[model samples]
Target: MSTPPRPGMESLSLILLRRPPNPPDLSDDEADKIQQAHLDFLDDLRAAGVLGAAGPFRDHDDPTLRGLCVYRTTLDEARHHATTDPAVQAGILIADPITWWFREGEIHLA
Candidate 1:
């Protein structure tokens, strides 16, 4: 049987990154800049030890479902981080924060 979670342990949040249905028309340069900014944001999160994992969905050609970011933070904080993304701030993308439950040490990097 699986053991219960330890005290102080709680669920995290996963930001579902998606392209807006009616995305604003942005110049190629502007789009590139936003993309770069988003990358930089994720990098910062990783360095801050809040980004559990982040990557794009390459299984199909679904533009709406772009990627996801697993954040080791509260829902409010995760939402704030998602909104701070340049792409989201620029209205190029949208984010939906989903609660995730898992063992504290279940996830690890090699």
Candidate 2:
């Protein structure tokens, strides 16, 4: 048995993170710097309560599929936030919105 979703909950947006087909070649230091910037970007979103959840994918069917970001906003808003990430801007990671239907209260990030 499972509990059904309650009424009146808000919807959340989802964005899938992936490695570009032809990701830019960068030195290890450059890559690390971009990664750090990406983390800082996510932290900013968290502080602003825009990112409900975000993380990297360890094992996936497609190796290029890197991670996911669940946003507490509409699809457009989510896209706006994701596309602004330093990694995405640098072509280190790409973001694609995926339609995901779930009540907002269903997820929370500490």
Candidate 3:
């Protein structure tokens, strides 16, 4: 047997993170500090169950920060929460809000 899709609608999503087109101009010490803060933020999100996955995307020799964070709520909610993240507050990321969507294979209702 196969599972059926849920009726009605599902939650909206947003991806908020920073990605430099080129290499960052941060000193080694500054980089370390920012990285630590980013890790800590991820920890917080994971604990909250709002973070499905996250990581950086490197292209060529430039170290561009291409990361993703999945939030289980509407775009507005995601944006609000993301803006409050320590990484965003630390100026480490030029957080961009992108609204996206996906189909749920099976949704459990209580």
TM-score of 1: 0.82
RMSD (Å) of each candidate, 1 decimal: 4.4, 4.8, 6.5
CA error at residue 2 for candidate 2, angstroms: 26
lDDT of 1 by residue, 2-109 (tens): 233665444667899999999999999999999999999999999999888899998787769999999878888899899899989999989999886666666664
What global local distance difference test value does model 2 have? 0.85
Please provide, for model 3 over 16-44, each residue's C-alpha lDDT reduced to its tens digit, 9 standing for 90 to 100: 47654544578888878878877887788
TM-score of 2: 0.84
lDDT of 3 at 46: 75
Task: Look at candidate 2 and tell me the lDDT of residue 36.
Answer: 97
Model 1 backbone overlap count: 0
**TM-scores for all predictions:** 0.82, 0.84, 0.65
